[model samples]
Each structure stands twice: as C-alpha cells, then as structure tokens.
Target chain A: MRDKTILLVEDNQDDEDLTLRAFKTNNISNRIIVVRDGAEALDYLFGEGAYAGRDLSMMPTLILLDLNLPKIDGFEVLKRVRADSRTRRLPIIILTTSHEQEEVFRAYESGCNSYVRKPVDSAQFRDAVRDLGLFWLIHNVPPPESE
Target chain B: MQTKRFAGGLRIALVLAGIFLALASGYLAGIREAQMKASGPALTRDLTIVLFGQTLHLRLSLSALGVTIIFVLTILLAAAVLFARVAHRRRRQVEAVNRKLMREIGERKRAQDEVIQLNAELEQRVAARTRELQTANKELEAFCSSVSHDLRAPLRAIDGFSDALLKDYHDKLDEQGQQHLQRVRNATQRMAQLIDDLLSLSRVTRTEMRREEVNLTAIAREVVTELRQIDPGGNVEVIISEGLVAQGDARLLRQVLENLLGNAWKYTSKQPAARIVMGTCKGRNGKPAFFVQDNGAGFDMAYASKLFGVFQRLHSASDFPGTGVGLATVQRIIHRHGGEVWAEGSVGQGATFYFTVY
Candidate 1:
C-alpha cells in the first residue's frame, strides 16, 4: 500500500476536484499527492523547496501529468523527470484537454506511459481516469527497481 | 551608327572626287598646261599629218603626249567608277546590318518589359495570398485551442457537478429534479459532441495531407466493423466492391467513408431491412466516381444543395442527430485531393453520394 502512492499534477481546480472524485468513485484507495503546478510537482518529486525535509525514498509509483501548466509546462517537467535517474522509471500518463494529433505524437515521443484526452462528458472522463488508476496501480507491473 | 556614318562620309568623298575629275577633264586648263610641260622628249615631238584631205600641222611628239594623257585619264576615270560602285555596295550592307540590329533591340526591350510586368503581378498575388493565409491561420489557431482547452473545461465542470448533484442529493431533490439533472447532463454531452465535430471540421482543413495508394475497400470494411462494434444490434447488410483503391491520404479518406457510411447506417435505423452498397460508377459528368448507396430516409432534391454546407441539415435533430458538418468535411477533404463530391436522393427513396478524386 505504501508503494502504491500516486502523484497527480493538475492546474485547474475543477479538474482536480473531478479527478479526485473519479478515483473515489472508482474505489481506488491509493494515497494521492496533488500538485498545482509543474514547479510544485518537481519540488514534490525531488523533495526540494516546500518538501525539503520530506523523505525521498517514498516515491510515487504512478504520475498523472497534465500537458498545460503554469510556471513550467508539462513537456519540460517530463523531460526533467526522465533526465533524472530517481524519477526516470515512474509511470507518467498524459491527461490533457487537447485533442491535437501533433500534441499526442509529441507526448508519446517525449515518453509518457499513456495519453488520455480529458473528454468533456463527465462519465467518459470519469471512466478514463478510473481505467488509468486501475491499470497503473493494480494490474500493470512497474519497473523492478522503481521503488 | 558608326558604320552608317562612315558610309555617308565615303559617299561625300566619292562625290567630291567625281567633281574634281570632271573639272580636270572638261574645264581645268591650268592642270592640262602643267601636264604638257612635264612631258619628256618623245611626248613633246610633233609631225605634219593630213586627215580627211585637210592638212593639219600635227607635232608627232604632241600627239604622243595627248594620247598618253588621254589614256591615263581614262584609266583613272574607270578606277574611280569601280571604287565608287564598291563603296556603294559596302554602305548598303552596313545599312541593312544596322536595321537588323535596331529591330533586335526593339524586340528585346519589349520582352524585358513584359517580364518585368509579369514579375510585378506575381509578387502582388503572392503578397495577397500570404496575408490571407496568415489571417486565416491565426483565426483557426485561436479558435481551435480555445475550444479545446477553455470551452470544454467549463462544460466538463458543469457536467461533473451536475452528475454529483444527481448522485449525492438524490433523496433531497424530487424525481423531476433528478430527471432535470439528467437532461442537463445529456445536453452537455450533446454540446461536447458539437464541439468535437467542429474541431474535426477544422482539422480537415488544417491537417497536412500525405498521399499514398490507399486501399479504400479495406478502410470501408474497417469502418463497418467499428460501426458494428459500436452498435452491435445493427442488422444492416453491407456490400463493398472488390479492389477499391485510391491515391490520397488514408486517414482523411477513412474519415470520409466513416462519415458517409455512418450517416447511411444512422438514417437507415428505422428500416426493417437496410442495405448499403459501396462501389464505383460513372458520375454525372461521365467521370469515374466512388459512390455509397443506402436505402434510407432520403432528402428532397430542392434542399440537396444545402446538404454540404456547414451546420445545414435537411433532417431534424430528433430524427437524425448530427452537427451537419460531416458532409462539409467530406467536401473539403475531397476538394483538397483535387476532387469533387455530390449527392443524389429523392424523398422516401434513398441517398447516393458520389465523389471523384484525381
């Protein structure tokens, strides 16, 4: 259960609430650490700034990353995370509102585990978030040395 | 100009020499007296002679001097005449060459002027097109991103919170309130579909095209398979012709077939037995056109022209739910491939969409 922690990086408050509700509705009982921006996400991941005294060994097993963010964008965050050995093997899923094909290709090219378009329909969005949670948390096998 | 001027000078010199020869031979006495003084002993000796019964004191040396003078003058005159003729011929040749050069210069000047005019026109056209493209591109970019990010975000919140109200406040609210929330959710979903459809239409215009040998039959079959998966209860009989191939972007062409076949499947929902046929046949202009024929709720011929216009629908939302952008997208993609699309249908009969790609 400790190793099944999740990191959710989202900017919009409504989307954040909806995502939390989706996980709760789907009965995914993993501990989720939410970050408002890409900078906070990096800080949380590296245990720097606001999270300086926090233990670095307890890394989140899965990350739900949003493409559009303030202070630092999603692509940059993905690059910096993949560059570091500590968070390199973490499963990162891109959840974005953009339906652009070029953006999708770029996200995959930048090394995201999965890409999900945040559908405007509530049920579809909820279903998508639930599927991502179930697959990454319970079913799919993470890298052996990731923890 | 130099050759022509040189020829004129030579003619003037020739004419002056001719006047000098005339003065010396016919009227100039001082020149003849000098010639006689310069004669040698044999040229000066004169003898008595009789000619035609008239005795004339004829100095033999004098006759010899006259004959010698006459012979030299005749030779000089003949040489001058020959030189004049040669100079005239040379001048005519130079004049002819000068005229040819002037004509060539005129032609080159005309060609250069034409080229400059053409270049100016082309530059103007290019500038106009660039400005138009820039404006269109900027507008499309703003519209697409705003709709993708901003518009959908609010709508999703509304839908999500509405669902929450229905789920969490189920007992507090009356039955009608729950039903109203459901209606609101469905309305949001429909609006989301409209947004998606608009985005798709924009993408049809914006997406870059890659032409290849696309197996159209394979695409149609795949679309049909997906359609069947989406609606497992659909019992429509579909018949696709063999070896339907085209040179175009496969993804766009797949969208084309999907929209057409999807519409066919949708309109034929009320029919007991629906039949759809996809094949190639000659179009109205006698060109080979790929057609999708379906026995469905057809349209009137008078309103047919409005079918391909964006947001124009012949059927009501209750009967045939659509954003009315599918046919417009199909037309745009077909036009992008240097092709055209048209449809023919009579009310209560069926609809057949014919498209040709080059």
Candidate 2:
C-alpha cells in the first residue's frame, strides 16, 4: 500500500477539489500528487524543474490526465511519458468532461490505459472513481521493477 | 459598304471606256491620214456589195481597206483586255470577302470554347468552397459543445455542496433554509439537463447518416417495449402498423420513433384507458405518411407553431414534462431524407403527428 502513488493533472480548481473529495470518500489511501497543468505534470514525472534532485525511482503508479489544460495539453504529456523507456509502463487514464465518441477513440488510440467522463452527478462520479481505484490500486498487478 | 464597292467598280469601268474610245479615235485618224497620202492604185481596191433588194459595184483604195481592217482588229483586242482586267479585280474582291467570313467564324468558335472552360472551372471552385464551409460549420458546432460541456463542472459543485449541507447538518438548518438549499439543488440539476439536451440536439445535426432499407415496424416495436417497461403502471394500449418499411438511417429512425412513441406514452399518463396508435395513412398530395396518435391531453391548435421550438412547451411544466427537443430532432432527420412533418389536433381531441420519408 505504501508503494503505490497516483498523480492527478487537472487545471480547474473546482474539479480538483471534487476529485480529491471523491478519492477520499472512496478510502483510496494512496500518496496522491496534484499538478495544475501539463507542464508541471511533466516536471514532476521527469524529476526536473522544481522537482530537481528528487528520487526518480519513486514513480507514480497511476496517472489521471485532463485533456484541456494550459502549457501543452493532455495528449502531449501522454506522448512524452510513453516515449521515455523509464516511465513507459505506467498506467495513464484520461479523465475529462467530454463523452464524445471521437475524443474517446482518440484517447485510446494515443495509448491511454482507460477513458472516463467526469459526470455532473457527484454520487456517480464517486462510484466511478472508487471502481477505478479498486481495479488499479489493489486488484491489478504492476510490472516488477529492477529494485 | 455595298454601295462603296459598286461605286469603285463603276469608276474603273468608266476609265477603261475612256481609254478604249481614245485608242479607237487615234486609229481612225491614222487610217484617214494614210488614205490621204497614198497613190490611187495603192489606196484603191475593187469592191462588190449586196443588199436586201439591190446589188452595187465600186472601186476602192487598197491602203484604205488595209487600214480599216487593222483598226477593227485593234478595237476588238482592247475591249477583250479591258473586260479581262475588270473580271480579275472582281474575283479578288470576292476572295477578300470570303477570307473575312472565315476569320469571323474561327473567333466565335474560340470564344465559345473559352466560355465552356470557364464554366467547368467555376463549378470546381464552387464545390471546393462548399466543402470549406461545411468544415467550418462542423468546427463551430464542436466549439459550442465544448463550451457547454465545460459549464457542467461548476454546476456539479453547486449541487454536490447543497447535498453536503443537507446531509451533514440536517438539524442545524431551519425548514426555510433546507427548502432554499433544495431549490438550489433542483435549479442546478435542471441546468445540467439543459446542457445535456443542447449537446444532444447539436449532435443529431452533426452526426453522419447512412441510408438503407429499415424495418420501422420492428424498431417501433422495440421502442414501445422499452416505453412499457418505463411506465408499467399505465394501462396504455399500443397498435403498430404491419410492414412499415422505409429507406433511411436505421439508428436515426429508431431515435425518431423513440421520441414520438415516448411522447405518446408520457402525455397519456393521466388517462384511465389510454390508446396510442402508430400507423400509416395518405397525407397531402396523396403521399404515404406515418403518424403517432394518442388520446392524451392534447394542446390548443393556436400554439401549434411553438410546439417544436427548443424548450418550447404548450403545457405547463407541472402538467407535462419535456425538453421540447424531440420533434425538432425528428424534423431534422426526416428533412435530411427529403421529407416533411406536420401535426393536426384540437384542444383535448388528441394529437396526430404525420411525417413522410421521400
């Protein structure tokens, strides 16, 4: 349990607060890192900029990405993460407000692990977040590391 | 131009005549001089002449006879040369006219070809512009959807916190305070519904359509079954026409039936023994029209024009609940298939919606 961590990259403050509350309500109980935009997310992931000299071995177990963001959008962040050999196997789930089929297909085609829409109904949103945590944080197995 | 050409020909003819007369006179003068200067034996010659009723004999000068014969030959030769020159000039003028006509015909042919080429180019340009405009329209629709989608986040927050206040501090709030919170929650939810409905309306227009032979009868059967499940307590009867087949997009046609039949189910909720019929009949111009009719709380005919407008409802929200987007969507789909839709009913007399797919 102590080994798992989740990174949330969302720009909107309201959405960030709601997502945090939903995670807490579901008893996810993992180390959660929040970044405001795409550029900050990259810095945190690559241990660069403000995160310089941080231990790169402690990688996030899961990534929740919002497609609409400032300073490089979600697709670019997903691309750079997958391109790096050190972080290619991390699970990247797209969490956004759009349920359009074209956008969903595009997310999967660009190598996202899962796609989920942020429902306007808060109770439904909590249930979706809980199911996501149950699957990724506990039930599913992660690839073994060199350590 | 014709008069000028004729005048030119006349001037040449007159000049040739003057030269001919001058030459004849000069030859006659020379003949006279020769006859006057010659001896009698040289100038004279014996001659015999025969007339209609008498004969005559005379002696004539040889030189005068020779001079007369030479003068006659010279006159004839000059006349022949002059006629030939005029004929050659007339032939050249005719050739010049023919060449002008040929040049005119060639120019007209080139101009005609240029026009045809221009028409083809214009058609190509029109097609390209139409495609560009279609692309721009699609982008605008997408932008509208995005803005509406982003609006839901704050609304969810408002509704969620209202629930929080109600759930966490139930005893701390007074009755009026609780009611106010409930109202706030309701308004937020309604706004969310509006956003969803708006997105769907735009989606229907933007979606691509595929035409095939669709068994609308079967689709209606499925929609009615679903409606029955939703409103199981109502004792509503549904009658569907057999073999209602048409050419259209199957998915979109299914949506049309759902909206129409769903309305039929919803409006008749107050009836004790409700009857809803889905059938085909002859419409205006004798075209086959499909209709969904119900013995429900029908609306006044005066407000019929506003029935299909977005969020427009003839009945009060308390009486009947709807987003009023269904009929508009139906109209769009049918119109896409080159069809028309209309309705007919009076107050409390039940309503029938008729639509044709061309």
Candidate 3:
C-alpha cells in the first residue's frame, strides 16, 4: 500500500463526501485517508500528532488539496510539503471550486502537480474526478521513493 | 487694455501741446521785433523838432528804440519764463501719471503671479486626489475578486451536495421530498448564476480596456446568430445593416452587443412575429450611434433611468429570467470607452438601445 494511498485535505464536510462519492462511482478503490484542515495535513505528513507512530516511508502517491482551509491554507501546505525531502516529490493536485486564474497560477507556482476546478454539475464533477483518478492512479508513474 | 491705450494717447497729446506753445511764443517775439523796427524813424523825427539838437535827433530816436526794445524783450522773456514753467508743470504731471502706471503694472504682475501659484497648487491637489482615487479603486478591485472567490465555494458545496442527494438517494425519498430537493438545487443554481454575473460586472470595471477598430456589424451578426442557435425555432426577423464600425475594445464591444441583442431577443419571445434591427444612426449629439431596436415587451419611460443599474429589473422573473446585470455590464463597458448609452422604450411597442463611442 506504499504508493496506493490517497490523502484528501479538505475542511468542508459536504465537499469531502461528494469527492468520496465521485471516486467510489469511478471505481477508484485506493486506500483513501482524509484530513480536515491544513494543520492536520501537515501533522499527518511529518508523522506527528495523531500520526506519530505511522511509518513515514509509506507516503501517499497523490494528495488532493483544497485552497480554503481552517488552518494554514492549501498554498502553505503545498509549500511545506515541497520544502521537506520526505514529501517533496509527492504528486499534489489542487481540487478547489475556484476557477480564478490567479489561484491556478499560484497553485502551480507553489509546486502543485495539477489544478482542477470543482464543477457545479454533479455529472461533470464525477467525470472530472474519474479522469483525474484514472490519470494519476493508473496511467502516470509515481516518482521514486526517497529514503 | 483700454486704459493703457488711453494713457499712451494722452502722453502724445501733451507733447504736441508743449511744442505748439513754444512755437507760438517764438512767433510773438518775432512780431515784437518787427514793430520796434517800423516805429524807429518816426520817433527820431519827433525828437529833432522838440530839441535844438536837430543833429541829436538820431541819438534820441536810437535811445528811445533801445528803451522800447528793452521793454519788449523783458515782456517776451517773462512770457517765455511763464510758458517754460507751465511746460515744466505739464512734464511733472505726465511723469507722475507714468509712475502711477508703473506701480499699477507692478501690482498687476504680483496679482498674476499669485494666480499662477494658486493654479499650480490646485493642479497638485487634483493630481494627489486622482492618485488617492486610483489606490482606492485598486483596493476595491482586489476586495471584489476575493469576495467572489469566497462566495463561490459555499455555492458549489450546496449545489454539489444537492445533486449528490438527488442522484444517490432518489429511491429513499418520497415525491414531495424529491421536489423539495429539486427546488433547493434550482435555487442554488440560480444563486450561483447571480454570483457569476456579479463577478463579471465587477470584472468589467477592473479590466484594462484594449482599444481597436471593431466591426460592430459583424459582432452584432455573431451575437444574433448565437441567440438564434439558442432558440432554434425562434421566428424572429433579424435585420443587420452593413459597415457599422466603432473604435473600442473588441471583446468589450462584443459583450455590449451580446447583452443588448440578447435582451431584445428575450423580451420579444411572446410576440408572434418579432422584428429586431441592428444599425447605425446619428445620435442626439450628432455623433454616429449604433443602436439595437426590437419589437419586444418594452418598459415604461419613467423607469428608464434605472434600466442600466445593477440588479434593477422592470419585469418579473417569471415573465423574463435574468440576473439584471447584463445592462449594467454594457453600460460599464461603454463608459470605459468614453461613450454614452441610453434606451428608449414604450410598453408593448418596442425598445431601442443607443450607444456612441467617443
């Protein structure tokens, strides 16, 4: 399960549920872990707080980050993750409702692997989620694991 | 300017008068010398008869002439002295007037300098105020973008969740519950549309306009075609004149045409045979104005002033669906191009929107 784990950092419960449903409908059966805020995401990433005893070597293959979070925000999370060697090469995708060009530019500038706008229509959103899951989980090869 | 000319005329007149006085005094002195010469022989004859000195008559006449000549010369010298005194007084008066004029000119220069200084200060103040206004506008633009970003998130959540419920839990819910959920979804979608329209309106204000020669006729044709595609069965008659051009941002002008033509199309939906015309005409100010006229459900003239305002609507949502931001966006785009937009309409008759790019 080293590269099959997918961590989703999102504060809104409704969005989290919708995303999970989209993945399930698309048959993306990867072990999915959810963190509610940016700080918790950081804690889980560095193997601290509730995730202290967890093995740091078993890092997730992809991370879905929401920009508007309760603590530290998605940009700061991306920055910190890219700064550390353990999670620096982790493929992080910004999954947000904002289609603003500035936000997209900042996400890519902050080392996000991809940026996707959350569609208001459920069918379109499902399709977008399916495509993303298939592309990152099945098609794209992951970076070599760092010691 | 008149006073300076008058003063110059007076100076010339005084100099001429002084010269005339001097010449007249000289002529009088010459006449007195001639009279003394003519009476000289008679005076000598009278002296010879009275005295036993017939031989001394010439000497007496000569002495008498000398006395007369001396008296005449003294009177002439006195007259000359008086004329010189008068001329000197006139010169002093003219000099005093000249000094007063020089002082007035100095005062005028000071006043003019004060005016210049005041103008400079006012210009500086205007520049500073303009800078302040620019800064405020920038801040407002930043605030608007962030607000739009924040507002869309929750709307998406509501829309997304309702859609999930309807798709996944349809079997568990009753008919009433399903309708309620559908209404919720509809309301959320409408709200989302409103937010998007609001964002576009704000963007119209902040976007830097790129100006170029735009083919207004072509743009109108494109917009009308799109509208027709939207309602493929629409029996509306569209008439577009050729060679309508304007100088403005092409993208923004397209938006203007879209809003105006779209509005005309929507309002005329109830008409059996609707007519829409897009063309150019001379405006009230005699400038070339492009207009979109339609035989639609026109509005009241009294409420025309509120037509371009944001969120202002004359018709009910059920009759016509809109966020009421289209016209406001159109007005903003036109105003950015230094243009004016106004509408004329009569209830149940028709409406026309006119705009001119300066």
Candidate No. with top lDDT: 1
Residue B132 C-alpha lDDT in model 3: 97
Q: In model 3, which regions exceed 4 Å deviation?
A: A1-6, A38-63, A76-93, A100-115, A119-147, B1-135, B164-172, B215-244, B268-277, B295-302, B345-350
User: Against the unseen true structure, what C-alpha lDDT does each candidate score?
Assistant: 0.87, 0.82, 0.85
The clash numbers for all candidates, in the given order, read: 7, 7, 0
The residue-by-residue lDDT of candidate 3 on B139-210, one tens digit each, is 876676567667776776777878778877999989999899888877877787788788778878777788
Q: Write the per-residue lDDT of candidate 1 for residues B110-224, one digit (tens) a residue.
A: 9999999999999999999999999998788767877887878888999999998988899999999999999999888888888888898889888789999999999999999
Better of 1 and 3 by lDDT: 1
Q: Give the per-residue lDDT digits (tens) of candidate 3, residues A1-147.
A: 364989999888878888998999899999899999999999999999988988888898899999878878999999999999889999999998775556778899999999998877667788999999999998999998855
Ten residues in sequence with the least summed lDDT for candidate 1 chain B = B40-49
lDDT of 2 by residue, B32-99 (tens): 67766773334467777677867877675554455546555655665566567667777889899989
What fraction of correct interface contacts does each candidate retain? Answer: 0.78, 0.41, 0.41
Candidate 3 has an fnat equal to 0.41
RMSD of 3: 12.0
Q: Which ten residues in a row have the lowest lDDT in candidate 3 chain A?
A: A96-105
The CA lDDT at A8 in model 1 is 94
Instruction: Give candidate 2 regions above 4 Å deviation.
Output: A52-59, A79-90, A135-147, B1-98, B113-117, B120-128, B131-135, B221-242, B271-276, B345-350
TM-score of 3: 0.62
Candidate 1 residue B233 Cα shift, in angstroms, is: 0.9
